[model samples]
Target: MLTVKPILPRFGAEISGVDISKPLSEEDRRAIIDAMNKWGVCVFRNTGLDDESHIRFSRNFGRLELAPLRRDGKGRLAHRELFDASNLDMEGEINRDPSAVMYRKGDRLWHTDSSFMEKRTSYSLLLAHQTPKEAGETWFADTRSAYEDLPQEMKDKIENLKGENSLWWSRKLAGADISDETIENGPKAVHPIVHTHAGSGRKALFIAAHTKDIVGMEPEEGRRLIRELIKHCVQPQYVFKVKYEPGDLVIWDNLCTMHRGGEFDAENEARDMRRTTVREGTEPNSKDDDDPFTELFTGMPKSLSRLTAPEAEA
Candidate 1:
């Protein structure tokens, strides 16, 4: 039987006693799902998963989305499902140049993965292949708890609001040099600022860094509300942090939580994290016939285009 220990007063759990390398039995799978329903995040330590097994394991839960494509038309991992969340370059070395790593600074802002995708993103199963020596922890906020704690008046006001999210907007906010082509044609998604979480049957604030503005509202006023809501969502009571170990796997529901990456000495330390994102559904949303995310990967890696010469980048 799996042992689940709650790590925080409101949410987050640590699960143990499972060999994830092999297929999980239906009983074990349901228990994990139950834990996920109760706790927005679950930490599994010493999972002993490599890239292949990691991909295989996440498949048991839901359909995997293709990780963001690289501009150079190369992939380090065999599976497109494995998204490289590392501080390292494609060559697996630490990136020291500030400009070359500027785009990554966006990760520091609280956001849900692939929220800007047309399809609703559900769970993010992130595995640590390598860990930084210090200070590379990730923080998560219980948006569900945060939502329930909101003032009744505030809740009533925002009950039907929607946010227009954009991938380029966030990249631009992080001081990345987004190409004109991308700004004009990038992927955009509109989602409710507040929605009921299916598993837990609780309302959760789905707002995050990708939420650029509110739909059908004046820009500045809408953004102010988003900022205010985010402030409330990340209050100390709803927050917790996790420092990863090499074999740790942290599964989080993007629907009910917000997460941000912590600062590490990227110049000197290696934090090779990989993730398989399971969207709420396998099919694209009604509006997306051609994959809407195609525009994001068009140019060279935003950092490389600005910092390195063509030959040096290669």
Candidate 2:
């Protein structure tokens, strides 16, 4: 049996007492689902879940979204179901690629997982494999609460607006020179800005870094509104940070929350994280893309440091 304790007043919960590595018992599975339904984010501390177990645990809930392929056409991780959300290169060394460092910076922006995918993701389970000495907490924003708190006029204004989410757009914003061919090859998903969350029957704002523009409106006007809503949604009261310990797994509903990576000493320390995402709809919408570009999003600052170093510049 598992017990769930609420970590925040309205959104997060901590669940304990189940060995997440093994096949779940009916009681444990039901309890986990119930907790997930009520709490948008659930933290499991020290459950001892390895890569295989992590993938196994996720399957009990929904189908796992395969990790995007690397530049070599294979997932960087041993398993395609596991996303390599870390600062290490494929060889487990600090990455030295200049363009890749910039692409990784995109994760620092607040966004939902898989929003740029055609079908979108329902949930994301992020597990910490290694932690830096300090800083690097992951911050989450309660978008469901943000939507409810919206002014009636604002709600009416965005009632029918749909946001076009693009991985290329975010990469460019983060200063990555993604080739035009790569941009044209990636996913650009469209979803409603004011979405009625099917699981909770609550409304949530769907704005994020990946949101390039709102569909069917003048681009600048739509951008202004998106910015306004994001500002409101990420107010201090609606946001919280979770500092992870090794083996910690935090699961959050992608439909109702937004998250950003906290700053870390990227040039010196290591912070290795992995994730498994669950697809939203029953039917898969698009082909699995080999996203060696953005899949490499993580901390790697050695090259960036040299660019700004006085000795290197002069």
Best by TM-score, which number?
1
After TM-score superposition, what is the CA distance of residue 89 in candidate 1 from its true location, in Å? Answer: 1.6
Q: Model 1 reaches what TM-score against the true structure?
A: 0.90
Off by over 4 Å in 1: 97-99, 178-185, 282-295, 299-314
Model 1 lDDT per residue over 121-236, tens place? 78899998889788889999999999999999999999999998976677677787777466546567899999999998999999988898899889899989989999999999
Against the true structure, candidate 2 has what lDDT?
0.75
Cα-based lDDT for every prediction: 0.79, 0.75
Best by lDDT: 1
Instruction: List all candidate RMSDs to the true structure.
Output: 4.3, 6.2
User: For candidate 2, lDDT tens digit of each residue in 41-157?
Assistant: 989998799999898888877767765444356444788778777776766776655644665688888888878766678878888898988987899899999899888988898
Off by over 4 Å in 2: 73-75, 178-186, 283-314
